[model samples]
Target: MKRQFKKHFSHNSELKCFFYRLHFHYDFYKKWGSTTPISLSFWVFTFHVRENICNLTLKGSVTVKIISVTRIIDDMGRIVLPSNARKALNLEEDYLIMRIDNKKHHIKFSSSGRGKEVPIDESGRIPISPDYMNKLGWETGTEIGLFMQGEEGVLQGNAPSCVICGSNQALLLVKKTHVCEDCIHTGTEASAEKWSAVLNDLFQEYKQYCEAAVTFTNTEDVHKARTKGRRLRTLIQFIGIKKEHPLYKCLKEAHDILGKVREDDVFIDAFDKEAENNQYSELYRKFIQKAEEEREEHRNELKQKLPHIIDDEFSARWKTFSQDELKDCVYKLDIETALQKYEKEFSERVIKYQKIKDKKSDKGLDSLHSVRKKAKKLRYIYNFLDLVQSIDYSRKSRQYKKIQKDYGDIIDLRDWINETGSLGEDIQDDHDDVKKVRKQLNQRLKRLVKQVEL
Candidate 1:
């Protein structure tokens, strides 16, 4: 039972209690299934089954008081979603996402809206949200391109009109996401502000989809993880954040996991064609040998990250557990207790550095970015602790998960590029490959920094 339980709720100590309770109920159900007590605890963290978009969807648009969305549930355990919210959001199901606005926070129900294609500018760049833009490294003056096909839909009246088409229907709003079906036929362009709001959300959405692919099965069926991993690597480079930033490590980890699988797959697929062509065998052999050496170097580097893994068990049993057990059992440790300590320390440090960052007047110093980056690490640690107590474990933590997936790709790419440089041979193809990879690394790094920052 413990082993099976671990498969689902392995990381967090708090969940152990819930698991036992659930198992107990299950046993009771077997003996007296109809008479089994239906209690609130049974639905504690479970999403309500009856919630759906129809219950919350708005007809067009409505101004809503954000504070109304942040109501806390009382002991009665009933929640009546406000009429405005219910109609505006069209929420029906129990899955909840908190949206923090300027005035207050709102509890939103998650719904699977049919995805729409985003319009791209003549340079083939997709319009992205500000948050997503920060995540994807598309700040001012970044070059881009767009390619779309088919007729999509008319843009909202308030949306920005197409640069060329001048049609109001062709426009898209600043914060909202839009997909352009006519982009392939007639390409458009956008200003930086128009697309920045959705960048983080878009990238996050894509990243989450990739992470989810690994949950149902051992392997990733979706190729987006690898593809987006490379893009994120490129963004990482563009940002030029320090290697120590938590975001850097997060992307590094994510890239490493997906990269290994990608590299292995790519290598195998290419192996057959290269092997069959005797005329090109020599060149292919060199490439394959270099790739293998690079993989080994990367594998060794990734192994070094495990030492930093926080042990939740130690913190939980600080008062009662045996010394040896306290030292050894991270999973068994009470993470909530330990996190309080970490948070207190982090708050003090942040306040101290923020004071320093405030002292510098005229322009924001580069060191401020470093200080901000450190604060981000604290945020990440806090988030991880929060997750340690739940079933979400790794699936929802994109920053850390991405790092675990993609670090190998960065290391391997670095080594491969280095080898090509050191050999001093006229391997133009090798150099091109290295350049391509470096570009990907930069993007990934940019992505890492963005997420690492608060």
Candidate 2:
């Protein structure tokens, strides 16, 4: 009777050669006899197979073991075989058979045979089937160990480690890269450093604007300085700087001084436009002259006060203060908490304003103004987070911008009426003209209020 034989190899640690193990089975009964000695050749070594085992002696000591390879599963659950392994297996075909052995707890890959055919991608990566991954409880960023068998490859699971710091504890898979919690905390510290640098640049910009305003270099410089001061104050508060901090107080004082100048500038510009009309030319002329005088007074105040506020000592102090405050500020946690708090407050304010509007009360204007300021605060906070941390809030910021513009127009007209009304009381002669201008502005304000949404 013929006997069947299956070939296997075992490593000889001392001799550095493979010893072939043969098994006689019933499946090879038609191909070989029970007593036949089979001749086999493998890589310059010749061997005669006996009953159940055979050992071939090499002419020289040769190492033939293929080194194991390690690879990380990418976000898409794909793994790449090393070039050497690919060459050794002669894996030239575009398709391979993948077999999962639950009993052996490993996956087997062969160039051909009966199994599920998986395509080798153009980049030479094989995507592990989702079903197989689910069965093995594997996820993206899992480490895999690959070793070559006779003409096949075996894949075994490995313990995952952080790609950034090689930490095995508290690993998080983010965008196919394993990151440990310690690295995340370090990243936050790095972010704080970045914010400190940005704040230093902002302080310098504020100083430049103040210089331009003080020198009267540009009429618009007053507005620019005020804006920069406001931004600085907002940033300082958000970064956990105390309101009593000298830097905050200095910025607030400068902001208030510039704000007065900006108000006069706005009034002067409005008067100049109104003076172009034949009907209100005399009234606007008088208003324009008074506004220009007040503007000069405010400008003089700014020239004196701003220089002292933004002098050399301010810069040096800001440099030291920003570094110290940012180091201790948990800005990441603060931003998230602030976002939630501001959003809730904004929503409540909107609802309250809506109720006030329903009553047709003049107080609705004040309530709406409160809502506008809340929106502005939310917008500023959103913008700050987006700029420093790359968190996206562009949509909310745009929505708030529209709200501020719509409400700001009404507020400006109301302020103009009050200013002219007060000036008319002082003059006592142009009271009728002031009343007419206030009437016209009231009509415009009503029209604008009608157009407002929420």
lDDT of 2 by residue, 65-170 (tens): 3335577889999999766667767776887789899987778888877778888876779889998888887789988877663467777785445443456565
Best by lDDT: 2
Question: What would the per-residue lDDT of candidate 1 be over residues 1-454, giving only the tens digit for each residue?
Answer: 4565554444434444555543232432243334434333222222111011111112221112121112322233223343343344443443323221223221112223334223323322223335533444444444322211121111111233332223323322211212122321221111111112222443555456454535424234335655554444333332233456444455566566556645544553454355466555555566566556655554444334322221233123222322222222331223334445645654565455455543322222233333434334444443433322223423334544444344334333334334435442545556555455435545654454334332
Backbone clash pairs for candidate 2 read: none
Distance from true location, Cα of 95 in model 2, Å: 53
Candidate 2 RMSD to the correct structure: 23.8
CA RMSD for every model? 27.7, 23.8
Q: What's model 2's TM-score?
A: 0.61
User: What do the candidate models score in CA lDDT, each in turn?
Assistant: 0.36, 0.67
